[model samples]
Target: MPRFQYRAADANHRIVKGQIEALHETDLVTQLDRLGLTLVRASVVTKHKRAVKSLTQQELINFLFQMEMLMRAGVPILTALGDMRDTAASTEAQHLSAGLYERIQSGETLAAAMDKYPGIFSEVVVNLVSSGEVTGNLPEVLRELVRALKWQHEIAAQTKKMLMYPAFAMTVIGIVVVFMMMYVVPQLTTFLLSMEQGVPIQTRALIWVSDLFLKYWWALIALPPLLIAGVVALAQANPGVRHFLHFLVLRIPLFGEVLKKIILARLTDTFALMYGTGIPVLDGLGHCRKVSGNLVIQDAIGRVIERIASGTSISSSFAAERLFPVLVIRMLQVGESSGALDESLKNVSYFYTREINESIGKAQAMIQPIITVAMGLILGWIMFAVLSPIYDSLSKMKT
Candidate 1:
């Protein structure tokens, strides 16, 4: 289908300019007519494929929030979508709304409409919406999705805050080290050697490293990215490599623990939504396997699914896997026993969410000092190595 940018006239005779995808000019005209507008002119912008970008998390949140509020106000789904299509700020948002409106108008359910835009909607969101459609809880599901997307954005921002300063600080430190090794150290080494004095061991080591930097600066700069890209490619192509790497990643110290909590928080939150919306335990678990983005967690969820399929209760299945924290397992047991599994999973999600926030805060607070000390150590070493041999030469000359 071709997308057309059209100039149209609404009922009040106001000119509207927007883009829509359709088969041809006729289809574009029809789409405009359906939107209660008359098409004045439309030129085909692109043929066959949608070139729109995907929505960011914040955009997705706002979109869902609007939809939820409109639905709650008793607006029909199509009308709500049409309103979105007309008022959308970004071309991508307009395209999303137009694409969904077109699909829904063609007799597909809202979930089915959203499924076509996999770039915009995750399987989790699609699954929740589908469940909501069946259970007549679409508004509630949309509201939950809005909340979840917001939480995800918050967590992501916090994680970035924790890592960004250190990354930048290290990059600066790296440049300084390279400059010192390649230029400063070489000049001082020549002076020390020219004086015909014995050079210190540390200065000799520094000169050797400096020589390597001067000789292979390009290689030093390029090798890290090439190796990283190669490892990523290998991981993508080989499941075993990916699994092993993911397993190791989960073992990495403080960073690993925070990552694990992030995954588990999403998992428990999704389960809470699934359970609250009347999705089946086994089905929800099946969908949640990839939520963690870690093979180990996915494998664990897979086993939990199998246990549930084999007649184990959900909480027991989680416990048997030995994967969840004691608090989570206890909450699951309580919720399962009390016939309020969703509430229990929500508590787990909240616990992990709070933990992740605090961890990020603490990690950020510690990163500044650690980076400072690391840079200080590097500078201290360079200063000591440069001055020691030169000072020794002066003292011996006086003697």
Candidate 2:
């Protein structure tokens, strides 16, 4: 592609000059003519380095919402995209819209035009749109897409809500611990030394721990990231390690169950959506695997696909894997027997979504008290160790 500078005149003969990307000046002139303008002067402009761009989640959601609304208004797909481009907040989306508009004007289908901007639209989205174009159901597909995005956004917000307080509390507790060890402990230890008498075992232990921490405080702060990086490298280097780590995550006490539910919800929702769009079961499972975000789940889904290929019933395949919950498998069984597998999967997604929300609530209620108590105990011990000797020495002097 080449960049071209063109001077054009509208029907009123008002001159306009702009740089546009095209194959050549001739193409630029052709585009200008399509825009109902005549090109007075055209020359190729130098191409510069192109920057890669991506839309944020919120932006994409807004775009989808607007598209759904416009589509419901009975506007043509290209016209809707053009209207969206005019109101777009980002230059990247504007460029994408322009390209998409050009493609549609050139007789390319709207879905095919969107396919050129995979960064802005996912394969699932493009395919669904293509299905809509084929089935003459663009409004319905866009409605479903908007619902899907809203569901995802809700899940993400819930996840953030679950984490935000714990993260803030942990940081506060860490700062308090560091302050007691580094600044408070050493000043109080002098009295214990001057007394030359037996100190409580717990106090001595606390003092020694504080001294060690003070001496190597920097190492304490850096250790977490170092350990995490080392573990990540090990996991990457060895498949067994990676698998073990994944298994370990699923076995974690408080969070593993929540994580499992969340992942399952995402998988079921995506699978349902794809299935609803007329994609085959096996193909839906394959696509779901790509978006599952868990390698273990991906492998399990692949196995499920293989089993389905071998003529096993959907529910039987799922039950054999034992990866999904019994509720989900039962739903699949019912769906398969009833010949409404897509609706059943949708119900499964809804079930897991409700479960995820309840689990998050329970976990949030349990975690705050646990964190507060544990941190309080640690800080109280440090305070006792640092204050006891001072009080003891003062009492002796008064006696």
Q: Which residue ranges in model 1 land beyond 4 Å of their true spot?
A: 1-53, 397-399
Question: How does each model score on lDDT?
Answer: 0.87, 0.82
What TM-score number comes out for model 2?
0.86
Which one is best on TM-score?
1
In candidate 1, what are the lDDT values of residues 33-102, reduced to their tens digit?
9789999988988776564569988888989998999999999998898788768888788878878877
The candidate maximizing lDDT is 1
lDDT of 2 by residue, 37-132 (tens): 899987777855344377787887787788889989988877787677656788776666667766787899978988877787888888888878
Worst 10 residues of 2 by lDDT: 44-53
